[model samples]
Target: MTLLAENYENDPIDVLVGDWMSEGNMTVRAGTKISGQVDAYEPTFLEALQPALPHIAKYRIKVAVNAGAADTKKLHEAVTKMVKGQGLNLSVAWISGDEVLPQLLEAQKRGESPFENICTGESLDDWDFEPIYAQAYLGGLGIAKAFEKGADIVVCGRVSDASPVIGAAYWWHNWQRSDLDELANAFVAGHLSECSSYSAGGNYTGFKDLEPLGWENIGYPIVEISHSGEVVVTKNKGSGGQISVNTLTSQFLYEIQGPWYFNSDVTAILDNISFEHLSTDRVALRGVKGALPPPTTKVGITAKPIYQAEMHWFMTGLDIPAKARMIETQIRMLLAPHLSAFSHLSFQIIGSVPDNPTNQNAATVDFRVIAQARRAEDLAPAKFVRPCIDPIMCAYPGATPHLDLRQAFPKDIFEYYVTLMPQSDIQHRVHLSSGESIEIAPPAESKVYSKHQPTQHTTGNVVDVGSFGATVPAPLGTIVHGRSGDKGSDCNVGFWVRHQDEYAWLQNLLSTSFVQSYLLGDEYRGGRVERFEFPGLKAVHFLLKDHLDRGVSCTSSVDFLGKNCAEFLRCRVVDVPLRFLARGRI
Candidate 1:
């Protein structure tokens, strides 16, 4: 590789390959503590290496992987394994540019800007840094490290999605670290390609019903970038996604906090770029202007994190037409009075009959109430509601006792959106291999980052079993009889929950006749209480094999369960806490 004054001037690099978003990142709740370990995951080193593919031989690549673990040991192990799996005979290792840990603490020290630490407020020194798992959304500097290391492929976790593109932009354009405007343009590039398809044309308003674009094969957003910071969003040969003005318009909606947010030692003037529709799945980007970033890079940090408290209570009730009405009234009069002191309030009617597009007037509704305050103790004074269920029901004034409410009530307790931001001057290092070269081609499969696939199609069926609160749920499930019969994967199992002293009751019942049982048990029971048969209740678990998918069946891969399992922890099931129960009209 020879140095050239015009490297970025003309005949710019033909292809810049990069990967983003490793694996799991479900931030835990931040209690009184400011810096604690959270469950974070990025693609294993092997997974990251796979993306580099056979192209390792010819081109200079940057394989960026986000070490997003607060646990440095695990993070490093995964990264090391990734490279070792490639036999270390590969190319560049341009780890993620996002510097999550130390920068966060540094930001806490500076107090310049609040850190978007993924969770709540965090102080740098107090944080448990995972060198292997830590990610900083570091932008140019992070990916530039890989370029510096001579890596051709950049792999990262939780990068602003645009960090890779921006890093490449900065490198290819030869845009100096002092150039804020150019750096920002590079930032835009990364953002455009982050969601893959959104930029290439997944969920564009102009092409809502893309007739010719078969969404199943919708390719993720890819960019034909210019050294001058100009770019064209596109995808692989004959992929399903569209790349029109519509797609570009949709994917751009994220990451850009207009007047825009310029990250860490870098900033940009967002309005300078021009978007043009070239052809299907091809959108051209022009007139991207940028400037030198602010001196200090804003860092995001989270306080000591705590697991989100999840509590599920299920109580069944039946009363043809009046069930919905009675439950509403009871909650308003009984539950509401007690829970109003909290932060959020949710009420849903889950049952055979529809709720949203109310189908039959005959279906009975399942009254589900979800409420969350600051902390467990934030609503501590009101914590009395958990135990008040039986007593309150026994004293019901209704002709039918709401007391014998056969169903269970499950409420997951988690704070909605609590994150922080900080700043730092962390210099990242990218590793380039001095080993044998490997040939590779463009990213052709697993086209995930496209906006043209599916949009907010479901209105969140207000009637059936929907998420308790906070807009979307991980794997959307539906009632088998209605919407999701064969659309995805659904499995029916007798669902059961442990209440008061029902542990022995459940064990005795399970010991009878159970097949392939999976219990939602705790420390006492190895969560192996697979055999569940609640005396008066019924629970079934369903998986939308491709519930959140189009072409691929998640089960096709052994890691599929692990993929969504992470999402499950943060997700609510069938208006309950069943890890696998699903709902919807399919």
Candidate 2:
């Protein structure tokens, strides 16, 4: 609400939307619900909403959010009572019926299981983990229904992230389910705005360019949509931030797989998408197309605790690699007799010795020992760090550990299960404060639905090294701007140039094989990697399948979400044309 209030004061904002749910968050909420916590929803939302209630009521601004988590009805009641106490006449509505774990478990008991892992072809029962709670990804129709019934605020549980914008636009335009293109445009816009300040220079790779904008006071994005679904995205005036085609392109490619961005209501096709710069702070988005949504909705399932833990030790001075190896050998020897207690275990050496050091800490390297177990007694908090400490007295020279050693204790590791459920199984509803309710009908699957197909990437003709005239070996960042993020277990990277001439060269240079050779090499090889081009936006996008090590649940990778994947690729040395280099880069 801090940022939302800022935008509201700056512009005549009609609606405020917040997206506070993620895959991991669903697992946490499920645990809380099963544990019988009184308030299973987000606790901070009410505190944030309390200060903004007066402004919201005065301006007649509608608020929507998915902070309802596992209990939308509880959230609605709490917010309604708070509003009445403050002498505000605002109506609060909520959408529920997203929970489906009980039914799934009952079906499993009757030997009629329909749930299967989307990535792995294993049935739910075949997996070792047991689900606690499950919720299907709901659409925007319920939220729109609340708005039509004059709801001042509409809270939802596990709906799609773009549903807030989709619902608001649907109510404003009185759009039907057949309005696929308009819904697609709204879906894309909501995605652009959902992360708030991300579209306004937060987490940008080119951080140097945003320094002048007072990063401490960075503003969030506000999108203006026309009836035809065309949009102009901008930020609050007189605030700190920057908006450009490059920034918008980065947000568009975040966490997306292929060209079909699936939602409960529509599948937005990002092929040949274009963005036009209307002003320094505003850009026009167009050419977004759509198809009928898939028959199934995405669902998240949380399983029993797959508890794991780790301990870190820092080694300083020369021969860091040998020291790390010796430590690992000692720990392995100690734990060899107790192998049955652990399901998985590994030792990792992070960082490298500095060539020349100015301080002891600068030349230090870190050694980590991590273990996972199915039983809590097997990997208790006190026993987990015993192996690491047993060798400290006779360890390598200059061996030391961090002061905060509490992290060595075992912790609950929730397994995130990603699967899909038929749209007919989900029951979407709007519970109004005035004792009225609305039921949203499931969308009819199209008979001629377009199969979600990825854009065919082309490996353009390779150019001879000497043909492009004088060249200099420099980081790819010298020629392009890029961003990367995670989508389930996959990582997506999109790199774009500021000039039209650079597009052709970029397309030819960054092919699927070229990227794999530069980044992954022979490590963790063998996965479906794809490359795509957006000529209108002058960008190249890549999706690396199963790159996040099981989607951050059990990944041992340093950069789990692949947020720095593009930055890693950007630092790769490339031969750049002297003409483009002379023009200067971001």
Candidate 3:
């Protein structure tokens, strides 16, 4: 909201779009709806917009957001009431038809739509948990239709994260549906802008450069897109945070699947996409090819809520491993009678006690025991907490509990199931302020593309790393910058170098086998590791399938969403060329 007001005061503003929905968020919203505690939409959206409403109305700046979450109509009504209360005449519209739980259930009853999991190919019938909610990823055309109908604000539920930008550009340019290239470019711009400050340097590995600009208020990203499909990414003038090729590259790589970026509206070919540093705080993105979208759109289905709880213990000084094992054994032995009650349980020892530590904190490591079950009572004090805590009296030397009673209580856990449904099944609709609802038709041209398409690349040939001369053992971060993010149970890590010469060495070294065996190490569980090359950006991308153990909502891993995967890989020692090392660290 602060950025919105600042951007409006500092620069020309068109549409302000915000994304507040994710797989985990959807699961949470579904639980809220089922419990009837409050409206399923994101309340923060209203809280933030309430302060900025006057500026938006005065400037006639359009607003679009997926803050509607599981309930678009309710959010639309609230926004309408807010506008009327403020005496503003701005038109508000809501897009719907993303919710498909009832429809999916009906189809499943008839043995029609199997609702097969996209990642594991398991049918919904085989899923043991009861599904409470299902939402299809709608296209941007519905939003475009709302704008064409003279809407000043649009609220959406389950539209793709990039749909708002794509819709805004489509309406601004009055482009036809056949404008694939233009739409694809807008898709890229939307992607770059979706994560707010990311494109401007929020999660960038080059933290040293952004220090002078200050991190307190990193600038929000803005894409100045032209009619020719060229995009110049920038931010509010005088805003903190640097907008450079490296920063934008980091954002580009975050949360992506592979070379072919799929959306409901169009398929963006990212293999040939390139970026150019135009000036200070400005980068131009080009060469994003376009193709017809798939006949099906991604769908997220959330099952019945589970319960989880954890207890943390500190292992200090000598015999750290022995101490951890002893405590874990004592707890397990005590809980053996009730072991079958827990659906999943784990004792994770985080960090290692170093030799001759200088401080008490450095010598201490955490041993956490996590428990998940279908019933909250299974993880209650009697069954879960007491067993772990009772062992402290007889524990190994220097064993101490973290002493947080609240951590022992059970919390709701939502499990997400990702799949795809045909676009033909969706009844996309736009509800305008004029009391008329319009139906949005799916794209006439769409191709049937397989998700397991053979790995393709635009890079001509592989480089011989031996030709780079003498090498030194150093952290990969010295010459490379990486970004990682989650998509359901899967995670992607993208690594790139600044110099063209380094691209050859990076591409040759970070192969699928190498990443799986070395970078992932014990973390590389049973799953496929797919590698992709982006020559234009001098980057290599890897997708770790089923890496997050059912993703953020249910994953017990410390890095649940796998956001730190890239940093972990970057910290690993690797053979770096002496010449590349001389070029200075990232």
Candidate 4:
């Protein structure tokens, strides 16, 4: 709200859009709805909008947000009440029909759609958990229709993360559904802007460069889209944070699956996408091609909640590995009687206690024991806590518990299932402030492209790294920067170089086999590793399928969303050309 208020006051703002839905968030919200402790919708949006209501109405600024979560109607009512209480005449509208649980269940019983998991290719019938909530990813047409109806604010549920920006641009340009090229441009802009400060340098690798400017208040992004399908991305004039090609490049690669970025309205062929440095804190996006969207859109289903609990033990100083193994053995033996109750159990030793450490903290490693079950009773303190605490008396010297009673207790965990649903099956609609409901029809033209199409590339040229002279072993981050994110159980890590000369070496050195053997290592498991290249950006991207163990909601990994995968790869020791290192490390 602070950033929004400041930006609105200083910049020529068109519409404000916020994304509050993710795969994990959908699962969490489903659990929240079932618990009835609070409304299923995100209440923070209402709280944040209360103070900004006056300014919004005064400037006649339009607002769009997916803060509606699982209950768009309830959020709409809350926002309307707030607007009326503040004596504001802002017309509010909401887009719905994203929920498809009933339809999916009915279709499955009738043998219409198998609803196979996109990542694992397993049919919904094979899923052991019972689905309680399901939502289809909707397009921007419904939001655009709401805007066309003179709505001052629009609420949405389960629309694509970039749909708000697409809708805003569509309304502003009066674009037709067939304007795939223009819509694709807007889609790219929305994707960049959807994460707000991320594109403006929030999670950038080069933080030292942004330090002098102050990170206290990193500015949010503002995207200006021209009618001719041109985009200029910039941040607020006086806000902290830098917006350069590197920052935008990092975000562009974040959370994407391959070069064919899919959406309901159109598919963005990103093989040729490139960025141009316009000036300080400004960049122009180019070469984003458009194509007909797929016949189906992604749908997320939340099934029976899994109960989980954990206890952490700290091992310090010498013989850390031996001590950890002894502790694990004891805990397992203690819990043997109740082991059958848990669906999963693991004892992971995180980090290595370095030899001859300078500080005590550096010499200590965490031994974490995590357990998950279908019932809370299976993870009760008596079953989980007693086993862990029982080993304390006879444990190795300096064996200590990182005590947290709350984390040891059982908590609800939502299991997320991702699949595709035909767009024709969706009843996309928009409810206007004037009591009129508009039904949004599916795209007139659609393509039935194979989901397993051969990997696409912008260019076929490959340079041998051995050709680069006088190679010295160094961290990849010395010459390359990267960004990573997750999509269901799959994780994507994209690495790019600052100079064109280093691009070929990066492409050749970081092959699929190299990534699986070196970077992923034990985390690779038995998943498929796929690689793609963005030649225009001088970047190489990899998608590790089933990498994040049943997605973020149920993942046992410490890096829950796989956000650290890129950084981990960047830290790996690699042979680099001395000529490139002469330019100074990133």
- What TM-score against the true fold does each predicted structure earn? 0.53, 0.94, 0.97, 0.98
Q: How would you encode candidate 1's per-residue C-alpha lDDT over 1-586 as one tens digit per residue? A: 1111123233234444344332223222212112344334443435534554444433433344443433323454455566567565444443433445555445556775443322222333343432222344445455664565566545544455556666666666666666655566667766677654655555443333555677676665556666655667676655576776545644554323233345554555444445776775567765556544443333323322212112222323334346445545654565545565555555544445433434333433334444444445533323434433433454323323234422223222211222334232444444334532222111121112121112221222223233323232222222111111111122112212223222222233233112213221120121111122212222122222222211112122222223223223222232332423322221
Residue-wise lDDT of candidate 3 within 1-586, one digit each (tens)? 6556645766877889898888878999988878888999999999988888888888888888898998889999999999999999899999999999887788789887777787666888998899998999998888989999999999998999999999999888888888889899999999999998999889899988888897777998889888877899998777799888889999999998987888889999887988999999889997898899998999898888999999999988888778888999999999998889899999998988788999999988999999999999888889988998998889999778988779789999998899888888899999999999999888898998777634533234677778989999999998899999999888989999988889988888887778877878888886887788888899988888888888888999988868898998898998899999887888
lDDT of 4 at 135: 92
What lDDT would candidate 3 get against the real structure? 0.88
Off by over 4 Å in 1: 1-39, 44-61, 65-77, 86-88, 91-136, 152-159, 179-181, 206-208, 304-358, 361-368, 373-586
Off by over 4 Å in 2: 6-10, 105-114, 447-457, 460-467
User: lDDT values of the candidates?
Assistant: 0.40, 0.80, 0.88, 0.88
Task: Summarize candidate 2's per-residue lDDT along 138-245 as a digit string, tens digits.
Answer: 888899999999899999999888999999998988998989999999999999999978888887776678888878877878988888888899987776868778
lDDT of 4 at 314: 92
Scored by lDDT, model 2 comes in at 0.80
**Candidate 4 segments whose C-alpha is farther than 4 A from its true place:** 6-9, 456-459
Better-scoring candidate (TM-score), 2 or 4:
4
Better of 1 and 4 by TM-score: 4
Candidate with the larger lDDT of 2 and 3: 3
